[model samples]
Target: MSEAEAVIRNQSGYINHTAKKDYGPLEFTGRIAGGLRLDLRRRLPLYASDWTDAFKAENFQKSLSSILYLFIAALAPAITFGSRFLDGTNGQFGVLEMIMSTAVSGVIFSTFAGQPLSILGATGPFLAYTLVVYDMAVGADVEFMPFYFWVCMWCSLFTILVAVFDLCALMKHVTMFSEDIFAGLISLIFIIDGVRPIIENFSENKMSLTSAMFEALLFMYTFGLATYLSHFRRTPWLLRPIRNLMANFAVTISLVTASALAAIYSSDTNLRMLSVDADFSPNLVLSDGSKRPWVVNPMGIERSFPAWAIAYAILPAIGFAVLGYLDQNLTSVIVNRFVRGALTLPVCAVLGLPLSVASTVPSITHVISLTTYEVKQLPEGERKVPSKVVEQRATNFLIHVLIGCALFLAPALKFLPRAVLQGVFFYMGIASLTGNNLFDRLFLWLIWDPAKYPQYHYIQKLPIRRVHLYTLVQVVCLGILYGLKAIKETSVVFPFFMASLAIIRKAMRFLFTQEELELLDSLPAEEEDGKGLSPEQPDLVNLEKSKENDEGEPAKATMGV
Candidate 1:
C-alpha cells in the first residue's frame, strides 16, 4: 500500500464523515470527474504532524515524473490568457509563441526543487491577473507592452531570488486560521468564475437552461468517454488505439472530429464543428507561413521599459512577486496534503519566467486546463507519492523535458477538441473546493468528541444547507466565467463579488457563532514517587496491567487519546 493509502486506513473518521453529502442532480459530474474519491483527509497533513514517515531527501524523481502533468496544467492558463495578449487582428503566432514560452518554463522548473504530482502551470489565478494587466495595456498612453514584459522580467528575477532564498519555508508559517481564509478565497474564485456566464447567457443568448444543460452534458459525456477510453487497457482492439490517438490531442481534436462527423450526419444540435466563437475569424492555416504577431505599439513604444525607467515599477513588480509566491506555496501545500516529499521553489523560479511567456500564448492554457482537470480529480491513493525530495525532482525534471519536446514539435501535437480545455477549467474549480477541507473538518472535529465530521452526524455546526448552497452558487459562477467569457464581460465583478462575499460571510460567522470553541487542554500531572518517577510510560492503554504496576489501564480513548 502507498503511504497515502495507509493514511486513509488510519483516518476513517475523516472520510466516513463526508460520505453522506447529497450529490444532487449534478452528482454524476463529480464521480465522472473523480470527485467522490477526492480525499478530504489531505487537508490535515497541511500541518506538521501526519508525517512520521516524511523525510525530504530524495523526491527529485517524482518531481521529474510530475513534469508531464505540470506541462499540461501550465497549458491551461497559458492558452486562456495568452490568446488575449497575442494580436487581436489577424494574429496566429501568439499560439506558437505561448507554447514555446511555456515549454521553456517547464524546463526550468524540471531542473530544480520540483514536486512530481503537484502539476504547476499557468493557473486560473494568474490568468485572472493577466486579464487585469492586459486591460491596463489597452488604450494606455504608456508603452504597456514593454511595461508588461519588464514587470514579468522583474517578477521572474524576484521569484528566482525568493526560491533560492528558500522562502517557501514561509508557507509553514501560514496558520490554519489564515489557511481557511485563503482556501475559501480560492474556492470562491472557482465558483464565481463558473456561474456568472450561465446566469447571463439565460438572457443574453436566450440559451435555455436545457440547452445549456445539454451543452454541459455533452461536454461531460465526451470528456468522460475520452477519460474512460484513455484509461482502457482491456482489449488492444480499435478502442485502445482510437482512444489513445483522440485523447492525446484532447478535447480539441475530439470536438473537431465530432464537428466533421456531425456535418456528415447533419445531426440536430451539431456536436462538432470547428468550435470557434462568433468574434473569432480564422486566417492562415498551420501549413501557411505566418508572420510573428505581437501585441505592441510601433510608434516609439520602446522608450519606457527599455530605459532605466522600468525600475520605477519595482513596487508593482513586488506585488506580482507576492502573488506568484502565494499561489505557488498554497498549491504546493495542498498537494502535500496527500503527496509527501520536499519541494523547493528554486526550480519553480527557473520555470516561472518561461511559464509566464507560455501563459502569454493561447493554446498552452487550453492543453493544460483539459489535462489537469482529468488528473487532479483522481483519488488520493491513486495520486500519492513518497516523502522524499530529490527523488521526486529527478523524475519530474526529465518528464518535463520530454513533454516540452512534444510541445515544440507542432506536427506531433494537434489532436483534440479544444472544448475540453474549458472542461479542465471546470474541473479545477471543483478541485479548489475539495483540496482544502481542513478548516471545515477541523471545526467539525472540535464539535464532535472522537467520532467524525457532521456530514456523518444528524446535525452540523454550520448548516448543511449553507455548504450546499455555496457549492451551487460557485457552480453558477464557474458557468458564467467559462460560458460567457466573463473575463471580457463580467470577470472582475464576478471574482471580486465571490471573494468579497466570502469575507463578509466569514466575518458574520465569526461574530454570530454561539458555540464555544474547544481548546486541547492537558490532564493534570499525577504525583509519582517521592523523587518523581518521571511519568514512567503511563502503562500501555490496551495492554494488560504490568506485573509491577498492578492495575489495568484505562480505556484507549480516555487514556492517551
Candidate 2:
C-alpha cells in the first residue's frame, strides 16, 4: 500500500475505505449480552491480576507530581461542594463526609477502575441533585436520610443495570466536537468561579473599599504569577532542570508564595481563608446535634419505604444512573481515548458516590507541572522537544490515597487561602480552554493575516465556512450547558444536555461531507498510532521529517494509493 493509504488505514482501520458506518438504533439486549459476556471473560482476570504495571521506579517524579497536583485539585471541589452541602442543609452532610467520600471513592476507583487516570470526586450536579432531594423530602415531611437511602438504592441498581448491559458503548457516538465543548465549558466555569469571590467581596459594603480593592489586586497578582510561572519555558539563564521544576510545580509554588504574601499584607485586612469546617473525627452525625452511625442500612425494616416514593424514585434514579454513566465514560474517553472501563455500580450504591469532576484540569496540570528537558542535537541545530520523565497514572493513584489520608489534616488545610486556590482554578481554566481544538480554530479566525495562520489539517482540507459552522455549533452548545449549570433547577439535567450534543453531532453528517466529519471527529494518524506504542518506539517517519525540516530540506510528496 502507498503511504497516504497506509496512514488512513493505520488511523481508522476499514472505516475510511467504505461509506461512513452508521450506528443503527441503540440495541439494549445486544449491548447487555455483550457486556455480560465481556465481563465474564475479562473482569475476573483483570481484578485478580496486577494493574500497577504502569507504576515503576522510573516514574517516581511523575507520580509525586500527580499526588501534589491532585491534593490541591481535590481540595477546591471538596471545600466548594462540601460547603454547598453544609449550607443548603444547615450542616446535615458535614465537611468530614465530603472529604471522606472523596478519599474513599478515589481509593476504590483508582484500585478497581479500568482507567486509573480519570479522577473521581464530588461534583456540582450530584451535589445539586442531593440538595433538591433533601428539599423535596423536607417539603413532603419525610425523614431526609430514609428518603435519600431509597433514591440512592434505586440509583445504584439502575447504574449497575446500565453497566452490566454495557449501555456505555452507545457513547461511541459522542465525537470530539461534543467532548471539547463539554470540557471547555467546565474549564470556563473554573475560571469564573475563581474570579467570582473577588468580585463579590469587592462589591460588599461591609469591607472598606480600599481593603476590597487590595483583595482583588492580590488575586490578580496571584493569578498573573501562576500563569507566568506555568508558561515560562523560554528563559535561558535558568538551568534546564530548574526551569522544568518551576513550570511543573508552578501552581503549588504560586499558591504558597501568593498565600504568604496575602497573609503578611492582609494581616490587618480581613482577607478570607478557605472555609473548611471539620472536627477531624471519623463518626458521622446529623445536623440536629444527634449521633448517627457510620453505616446505616438504607433498606431497614425499621424505616418504612413509602409506596408512592418507590414509584416517584425510579425516574430520578434512572436520571442519576444516566448522569453517572455518561460522566464516568466521557471522562475516561477524554483522559485516555484508548482505555474505556466499567464502573462498579453496587459499590456506588453502598457508599454515597462521587462523580468524576474537572478531570482534565488535574490531569493536564499534573502533566504541565512535571519538569521536562530538551535533548541537544549532535552538532549545532535546533534542540528536540522537551520530554516528560514519567507517566502520570501511578501518581494519580497515590494522590487519591494521600488525599484520603489527609482528611485527618482538614483542620490545618482550612488555613489555606481561598484566593490561592482560586488562582489555581483560574490557571486551570485558561489552560484547558487554550488546549481545545475548537478554541484553537476560533483563535485562527481572529488573526487578521491568513499567512500567519498555523497549518492545521482541518483548515487546509475543509471549507473555512464549514469550519466556522462547526465551531459555532460547539460554542452554542457550550452556552446552553453553561446556562443550564448556572441555574440550580436545570443543572441536574446537565448529562441530558451532554447526550443531546452527541445526538446533534450524529445529525451533522447530513450537513457536512463524511470525509470532513471524519477529520473533525477522529484522532490524527500520528496520535492514533502513538496511543498503542511505548515511548521508546518513536514514530521514525515523523522523527525523520523533523530532522529534515531542521536541516532546511524540502519535503518530498507521497504517492497516492
Candidate 3:
C-alpha cells in the first residue's frame, strides 16, 4: 500500500478525533445533512476562536500584510472588470454599483458565511452574462436596470433555495479535471482580455504602432518582473522574512512598477488610465443625472411582466446561481484543499457572489481565506518545509470594505493607470494557469528531462496515455465554453456551460477506472497530512524509517512497492 493509504488505515482513531474536533458537519466525510442543524450557539465559538487566534499579537503583522495583498489583488481588478457592464446611456449598473454590492456582500458573507477563507469577488463569467443581459434588454426595448434587477432577484432567490435545500451536495462528483478546466478558462480570459486591448489599438492606429509595441513590451516586462520577484526566494543575501514579504506583495509591486514606467515613458501615448470621476456619489444616479435606485424593484419597470419573460428569466437565474456556486466553491477547493463539501447558497455575478457554501466553521481555526496561486517547498535544514500563512479573511475583507470607501476618491482611482491594472490581471491569470496541475500535466511531456519533471500522484499512478487523454477531454470542454463565450448572444449561457461540466464529469467515470479517478480527484498527500498535524510536528513515519535504516535493520515498508 502507498504511504498515504497506510497512514489512513493506521490513523483511523486520530482521524475520528480530528474530524469531531476540527471539521464541520459537511466537511470531509461528516454528514452533510447535519450541517443544516448548525446554529449560532455551535458556530459562534468557532468564529470567536478563529477571530481571537487571527488577532493575536504575533499574527498582527501577517494580518496587516494580508489586507494589503488582498486589497490590491481583488479591488482594482474588480473595478476595472466591473466597469465593462456599465452603460451610462442606457442606465445600466456602473462601477460604483459593483463596488457597493461587492462590499456589502463581503461584509454580510464574512459574518454569516460557511467558508470564511473563500474570497468573493466579481468573476468574468458573471460579467459576461451581465453584459449579455444588457444586450438582451436593449434588443427587447426594455429598461436595462429594471430587467437586470428582476434577473438578479430571481438569481439570488434561486441561489438561496439551492443553499437551503443542499443541492450543492451533488457537486461531489465534480473531479479536479472539471475544476481545473473552469479555473484555467477564467485565467485565460484575464490574460487575453489584458492583451487584446493593446493588440486591437495597435491594429487601429498604424502611425502609433511603434509606441503601442513599446507600451505592450513595457507591460509584459513589468508583469514578468513582478511575477519573477514574487517567487524570487533565491537571493542569498536577503533575509527569509524579507523574501517572504516580497513574494507576498509581488502583484502590488508589479502594478506600481509598471504604472511608474508607463507614466515616465508612455504618458503621452494612447495608453488608457483608470477613468474614475473626480466627483463621486454613493447614491444611485447615472452620469446624466438619471435616478437609479440602490434597491431594484422588479415591478417598477415600464413594460408589463409577461409570463414568458418570467419563465425565460428563471432559466438564466438558475444558470447564474449554478455558475456562482461553482466558481465560489471551486476557488474554495483550490484554496482550502477541501474536495468533499457542499455549497449551500446561490450566487449572483452582478451583485457579486458570496464565497463558498460549505460553512468552514471548524477549519476556520487554522487560517482564513489567504491562499497563494503557488505552493513552493522551501528548504529548512535537512527537509523541505511547506509554508503556512493565514488568510485573515475577516480582516482582509473588512479592508476591502474600507477600500470600497475609496470609490468616492475619483482622483485617486483615476491615478491608478489602466495598464497597471491590466498587468495585475495578467499576473493573476498567468499565476493561476501555472499553478494548475492539469495545465502542468498537459505540457509535462514537452520537458526535455523526464527525471526533472514533476511526479504528482496522478502522474505516478496513472498511465501516461491516460493523463494525456484526461487533459484532451478538459481542453475540449474548455474550447466549448470559450466558443459559447465568443458569441455575444450565447454568452449569457456561459453559466449553463459550466453546469454542464458536472454532467461531463459524471460521464467520464465510464471511461476511467475508479482508482484513477480517485487519484485525480484526491487532494495532494502533503496537504492531507499537513491538516492533521500541528506545524511543529515532524513527519514521524519518515523519521522512523530513517532511524531503522541507520541501525542496519531491514527496511520497513515504504511508499514504493
Candidate 4:
C-alpha cells in the first residue's frame, strides 16, 4: 500500500459506526427507537462481560491503587467547584452540594455506564451556566433555588430527549481537528488554573514573604517530584518491577509527600488550605432562615416559582442540555467510546446539585492510572507507551464511595493545603500534554533542523507545511474557545463554540488535500491493528505498537484486544 493509503486505512476514532449504520427505513418514532438502540447497540452484548471483568479477583490490587489516585484527582475539583457554586449562587449551592452531585452521579455512572473508566464531575461551563441562572433569578426577584430547580428539571428532560433521539450519532461530523483543539483548551485550563493561584499570591502581595515563598516551594516540590517519579520507569535506576510500582503510585506518593511538606508549615497562616464544611448540612438558608434540606422540593422551593417560569426554564435548559450532551459524549469518545449520560441529568437536577459531566483530566487520569506501560530503548531515546489498561468499574465505584465518605472526614481533609492541590493540578495538566499530538507538533516548531525531527509517521511521511498548517488550524480554534470560555457574557455560548469546532474541522478539507489530512489526522497504524484500549486510541497516551526484537519480546503489548 502507498504510505498515504496506509495512513488513511489505519486511521480511526470518527463516529463512523453510527454514521455508517443502516438502521433500515423507519418513520420518526422508529428512528428514535433505533437511535436509542444504537446508543447501546455496541455495548449491550458486552454488558454482562464488562461487569464480570470488573470484579475479577486479580483486578482488586490495581483498583486499590487507582482508588487512592482517583480519590485525590476527584476531590480537589469537588472542593473548588463547590466554592464557586456557593459564591455564584449566594450560598444556594456549595461544597456540600458539589460533593453530593459528584459522589452520587459518579456511583450511578460507575455502576451502569458502558465505559466506567470515564469519570464524571462538574465542569467550568456548567458552573458558568449555573451562575447565569442565578443572575436571572436575582433580576426577576425570584428565589434562586426554585428557578434553579426548574432549570435543571428542564435540562434533565432535554438531555433525555437528546439521548432518546440519538442526536449524538451526529458525532460522525467531529474529527481530531476539533477534538484536539478541545483537548488543548481543557489542558491549558488545568495548567493555567494550577499556576494562577501561586502567581496571584505573589502578584496580589497578600502574605509575608516567607509564607508566599513556602507556598511556591510546596507547589514546585509536588509538581516537580511527581513528574520525576511518574517517569521513573523509563530510567535504568532500579529493578523493573520497583520502577513500575513507583510510576504507578506517583500521584499518590506526590500528594502524600506534598501534604507532609505542607504540614511542616502548618503554622504559616498565609498558606491557603482546602475549606470544607464541618458537617454535610446544606449551605443554602431557606426563607425561614433555616438550613435547607438535602432533598430540594421541586414544587416547594423557598420562593414559589411562577407557572410561566416552568416553561421559561427551558431557555436555560437548552444551553445546559447541549453542553452536557457535548461534554459527556465528546469526552467519552476521547477516552475510549460513547456512553449514555441521559441517566445523570434527572438525578443531579432533583438534588439541586451541580450536574456532573465527563471530566477530561480525571477521566484521562483514570485511564492512565489503570494503564500498564512498556518502555523500550530506541535509537532516539526510551519510548514509553501504554500496553494495556485494566478496564474495570470497581475503582470508579469505590473511589466515589470514598468521596461520599469524605463528608465525615471534612475536618481531616481541611488540613490539605490548597497550594498542594494546585501543584497536582499543574502536574496533571503538564502530564496530560505528554501524549497530545498538537502539543508534540507545537514543540516541532522549536526544531529548525529536519534531521533532528523524531521519526514520527506524520513528520516523516507528510509535508512539513501540511503538518504545520493542521496544527495552526487547531491553535486558532483553541484561541476562539478560550475567548468564549473566559468572558462571562460569552461563556453561556461556550457549548455552541465547542460545536463550531466540528464545522471548522470540516472546513479544513478546503485547506488541506485528502491525502495530507489522513496523514496528519489518523491514529497510528498499531492502534488500528487492535492493540489498544480506546478504539479511537487518542494521543492521550503516547502509544505506538512496537514490534518484537531478536530477544523474542512479545510483538504486541497486551492491550486486551
Top TM-score prediction, candidate number: 4
Higher-ranked by TM-score: 1 or 2: 2
- Cα deviation at 242, candidate 3, in Å, is 3.8
Residue 35 lDDT in model 2?
45
lDDT of 3 at 41: 24
Colliding residue pairs in candidate 2: 32-165, 248-369
What Cα-based lDDT does every candidate model obtain? 0.37, 0.56, 0.54, 0.67
Expressed as tens digits, the lDDT of each residue in 1-561 for candidate 1 is 246544654566554534665222112322322222332233333323222212333323223323444444345444433343342312322344444455545454433222332333454555555555445445344454455555565665676555444455555443333444444544455445534443454467645556555455544654455334323322356654353333333433333444344344344442322222221222222234442123333222334344543664454456566656555555442222111112222222222222331111122222221221111123222221112222223333443455456444443223222233334434334433432433334344345443444442213344544444433443443454344334554433443343343344345345334231111111112211112112122211111111121121111110000
* Candidate 3 Cα outliers beyond 4 Å, as residue runs: 1-34, 39-41, 45-53, 58-61, 83-94, 237-240, 265-267, 282-311, 331-397, 448-453, 523-527, 531-561
* TM-score of each candidate structure, all chains considered together: 0.48, 0.73, 0.74, 0.78
How many angstroms is residue 423 displaced in model 3 relative to the true structure, after the best TM-score fit?
Answer: 2.2
Q: Could you tell me the TM-score of candidate 2? A: 0.73
The order by descending TM-score is 4, 3, 2, 1
Worst 10 residues of 1 by lDDT: 552-561
Alpha-carbon runs more than 4 Å astray in model 1: 1-95, 114-118, 160-170, 184-290, 293-312, 331-392, 408-418, 438-561
The alpha-carbon root-mean-square deviation between model 1 and the true structure, to one decimal in Å, is: 17.4
Task: Report per-prediction Cα RMSD to one decimal.
Answer: 17.4, 9.1, 9.4, 7.4
lDDT of model number 3: 0.54
Given candidate 4, what's the lDDT at residue 157?
66
Q: Sort by lDDT, best first: what order?
A: 4, 2, 3, 1
Give the alpha carbon lDDT tens digit for every residue of 1-561 in model 4: 124322433363332544544342121324554555543544444556565664567665556767876786687668656755765677788777888888988898887775678787877557767887787677767777777788877776666666566566677677777767766776776688678878888788878778888889988998888778766655789776676557655666777788887887687657777666676777777768788877777665765667877777777777777776667776553112222335566666667788777786577767765665666565444554456667767788888898898777667766777777777767766766766778889999899998999777888788888888888878877888888777766766777878877777777889988888887787666545434333212345432222222221211111100
